[model samples]
Target: MITRTQLVGAWSLESYTETDVQSGEVSYPMGRHPEGLILYTFDGYMSAQLGSGRRDRFKGQDPYGASSEEYTAAGRSYIAYSGPFYFDESNGRLEHEMFVSFFPNWQGQRQVRIAAIDDDRLHLGPDRPMPFNGRLKTASLIWKRALPNS
Candidate 1:
């Protein structure tokens, strides 16, 4: 049986490879980045920092036709959200009740995550529906155990 104690620690994302359902292509957005970290403690404290990549064309362009800038806001590119988190051993699930979010719109929301723990990696997938481009899609995340003192 999986227990919460087994998941208590700081983990860094080793790779984030996803397949675009529409195009059937694989993409690795978070590869070899130290800025990604997920912490789960026994005291019910949880924090997650997801690194951001280059913005897509539409995301970086301004409606007013302003010159696009590269790496100007890249340094601040990261998704950070933290709050109280709970673990349900019966179903092997982790729920994150978000208090603060970098997106500002996700504040005060509970994100249910279905977690799968293995010998060296932990795969977390969203249990709730995620709206993408006005459509609901499933979002999955993976984290590898960070060696102690590494």
Candidate 2:
């Protein structure tokens, strides 16, 4: 079983894959090469920020003052959430009780993912397929422990 202490740290996104349940097709939601960070605090707080490998830059220099088109593109290429996390060793599950999320619908939702911890690598995915676009898809996210400097 993976202990909570072992999970406290920053993890870099290695890969994010989405599989179509019916057709068994695999796709990368964040492009072929994505970049992100998932951070777990000692106090049980956690946050995740994921982005597409390539994204269009905002026309304006100030990020906070971006134009509508810039904001639209940025929002569509990024994903982020933050909240408290809990581990159920007995069930081998990890629940991210989201306090805030890019999708407002998930703000008070608990995202429960199957936990698979292997040394410095952690693989998390949903037990069943969830609705995505117009089909049912399952996601598996691989993460590696971040170095101290990261």
Query: Once model 1 is optimally superposed onto the true structure by TM-score, how far is the C-alpha of residue 69 displaced, in angstroms?
Result: 4.8
lDDT of each: 0.71, 0.88
- Candidate 2 global Cα RMSD: 1.5
Residue 41 lDDT in candidate 1: 85
lDDT string, candidate 1, 62-95, tens digits? 5555344533344245568999998989887679
Every candidate's CA RMSD:
5.9, 1.5
Which is the leading candidate under TM-score? 2
Model 2: per-residue Cα lDDT at residue 2:
84
Per-residue lDDT tens digits of candidate 2, residues 49-76? 9989999998778979998888988888
